[model samples]
Target chain A: MLRVKNLTVDHGAIRALHGVSISIEKGQLAAVIGANGAGKTTLLRTLSGLNKATDGSATWGDLNVLHSKPESLVRHGISHVSEGKSVIPELTVSENLDLGALWRRNRKESAQSKNEVVELFPRLGERLSQRADSLSGGERQMLAIGRSMMSKPQLLLLDEPSLGLAPLVVEQIFQSIRDLTNSLGLTVILVEQNAIGALKIADIGIVLNLGSIAATGSAAALRDDPAVRAAYLGF
Target chain B: MFEFVNTLLIGITAGSIYSLMAIAIVLVWRSTRVVNFAAGGIALASTFVGSTILEITGSFWIALPVAMLAGAALSAFIEYFFLRPLLKRSGDKNQEIFLPIIATLGILGIMKAVLHFIYGEKIGVLSPPLSDKGFIVSGESIALSPLRLLILGIVLLLMIALTLIFQRTNIGLSLRAASFAPEISRLSGIRVDLVRTVGWAISGAAGATAGILQTVNGSGAVTPEAFEFSLLLVFGFVAAVIGGIESLVGAVVGGLTLGIILAIILMYLGSSLVFFAAFLILILVLLLRPNGIIGVKGGRRA
Candidate 1:
């Protein structure tokens, strides 16, 4: 389980995340939907240790994740895929995936994990040697997710996976995320502006109006809610 | 024809040493977005250590490794103590690099002063370990000396070793990742700071080798105010710029090209025009390819 309580963060002088809290169960997909400047990305950054939490605490198992370094979070099986298409531009698709597995010392286990990642995003298998800059936006996102998965993490913190991607590509990528969560017991806290598509596959939905959560419920309930739909779902 | 061949041979040897130095400069730049003017100072210091070791032990074998270790240590210390804090203070997204560049210049000056303080008016020799007597080429005894051959061999071995390390190792993968994307790399469990330090240390070793080779290849003497040592840094930087300053292979190519051309100029033109010619070549290459000969807009840089 991954938990955040009263977590706060600042991007420069702006309070991007203000005392927000959320909980994600094992093997569950939690979609965090918000308008621009709603602190969705800040929440993930704080959880992943990229941004420090000024107040409150976050936990993944026994780790006090609020002040931990980013690398420590990965060691505890919590991998974070940052905002946008996050593949290393200079590294090949395969090398980017290999970087995710850098901390893994076991050669056989690393190789097996790599195989699983390629299988999950098989398009990556065909373009293994291509530079990540050559990857289309959607494929780059898949490559990002696949690279993060190379660590075989139990909890994955993903920021805006569907941003700048075609609907068809989004569908394929989200399907893979859903499948991974369902099959491998992987947990995901996906931050996205595309609420409807993300909520479709997510088990729980958390809506942020500004810096704090305005609503949290089952995905269907949030999807059906009039206010959330009018504001976020665009339906 | 024999004179031309000799000049080319000498050029190749000198270019090989510059390639090592250029590689050092490129490594430092790729790891930290700082152009280290201090690399040459570190090289001079390492060469001094080698000279001392030679005097003490009377063996080039022990002296070389010791100098490399000294270089690595000094570079790591500079990265940790000086560059890290300096970078942190000015490393905001819109961080201007002029301050860092100036800071490195100050470091180079300070290091040179310190070396002068320690070894005032003293001259130390880095006598070649191998015979410097050139093998006879058509009975003319051309410029391909055995010691020059040794320098070439060591440089080739290091380059090949570096290639293998960068391409075939986990640490290498982490180093590449860290340099490419520190945030993503950190999230992927790479200690980017430590990797940067390692990168500097490796550069230090390269600089040390270049220093030792260049000294022995020339007057075989190192002094606190050695003009050749300062020139090594300048030429190395020039070579790096020519190669596009972002690629190791480019650095090697640039170094060799610079060496060959400089040799040709010294022979055909004049010795005084060597530095002027280097500046010209750098300007011409930069004008033609702003990125460099092997420089690409994106990809693994070093």
Candidate 2:
């Protein structure tokens, strides 16, 4: 389980995340829905060691998530996919995937992981030799998710995976993410602005407002809640 | 006709050395987004080390590799101790490269001052390892010499090795990925900082090779304030820019083009016109393709 307690983060003098806390159990898909500047990205970045927290304690299993560096976190099976498209555009699809497994020294295991990633996103397999920039927006998102899987992470933190993507493509990506959690038993903390779509697939939902959690419950309960719908889910 | 062929050969020989220097500059720029004006100083310092090694062992072979290693060490040191903190503190903003450029210029001055203090008006001799006498072709001594051939061979080999490393090796993948996107590379578990240092080391080695070759290819001696070294740095920078600063292949093309054109100008036009010709050529190329010959259009700056 990943547990965060009173995580406080500052952007210069301004507090981006204020005494926020959330927990995600293993194999559970948790969606963090919030408006712009709600500190969703900052929260994920702090968890992945990209942003420094002013005061916080976060633990992923036995590992102290706050103390670890971003690179070290990946080694400990915590992979983060940043907002928008995160794949290296200059690198070919295959090369990008290889990079995802860079810290994995065992050749056999790395190859097996590559195979699994390719199987999960067959579109990626077809475009393996092509440069990532040449891929479509949806395809780039798939490649990013598939590349993250190459690390075989126990906890995947995705920031705005559905941002700027078509609704049909977003459905496909959400379905794939759901499958990842369901079949692979991967724990996920998905940060999104698309509240309704994210809550539809997430097992648990946390609504963030102005850097603090406004509501947390099962995805169905949060979706059905009148207050959450009116404020965030937009009916 | 014979004079034309000889000039072409000489141009190619000189251009090959410039290509190494250009490659060095390009590597450092891509990795750190700094033009590394101190590249010339690194080369000069390492060449002095090679000269000292030569004095001790009397073996050019031993001196060359040692100098390359010393260059690599110095470059890595500067990147680690100086540029890394400075860049971090300033934030990795590409538009703010002006500061790094000014900072590198300061480093260049410091390096030259240090070298001057150490050497103290003493000249370091880096005589050609192989025979400098041109080959006899139809009873005429052409400009192509054994030492020039060796220089060409070494430059070609280094280029090939670099290409293979960037294309085939995992470390190369990290280097490419880190330069392209440091945050994403870190997420992929690659130590972006270490990879950047490695890039600097390679660039230093390349610059060292160029320095040693330039000395041997020209006056066979170097001083702390050698004008030739300054010229090498300027020409290399120009070459890198002409080749589209981002691509390795562009560096080679830029270097060769600069060398050959300068040679032709020196031979037919006049020696005085050579320096100005470099800028004129650059402006012309930029006019045609603002991104340089091999640079991407509307690409991300730095």
Candidate maximizing lDDT: 2
Best by DockQ: 1
RMSD to the true structure for each prediction, in A, is 1.6, 1.8
Off by over 4 Å in 2: B91-96, B283-288, B300-302
lDDT score, residue A4, model 2?
Answer: 96
Off by over 4 Å in 1: B91-96, B297-302
Give TM-scores for every candidate, taking all chains together and pairing residue i with residue i.
0.97, 0.97
Cα shift from native, residue A96, model 1 (Å): 1.4
For model 2 chain B, where is the 10-residue window of minimal lDDT? Answer: B293-302
Model 2 TM-score, 2 decimals = 0.97
List, residue by residue over B32-93, the lDDT tens digit for candidate 1.
Answer: 98889999999999999999999999999999999999999999999999999988888565
After TM-score superposition, what is the CA distance of residue A137 in candidate 2 from its true location, in Å? Answer: 1.5
DockQ, computed on Cα atoms, for candidate 2: 0.68
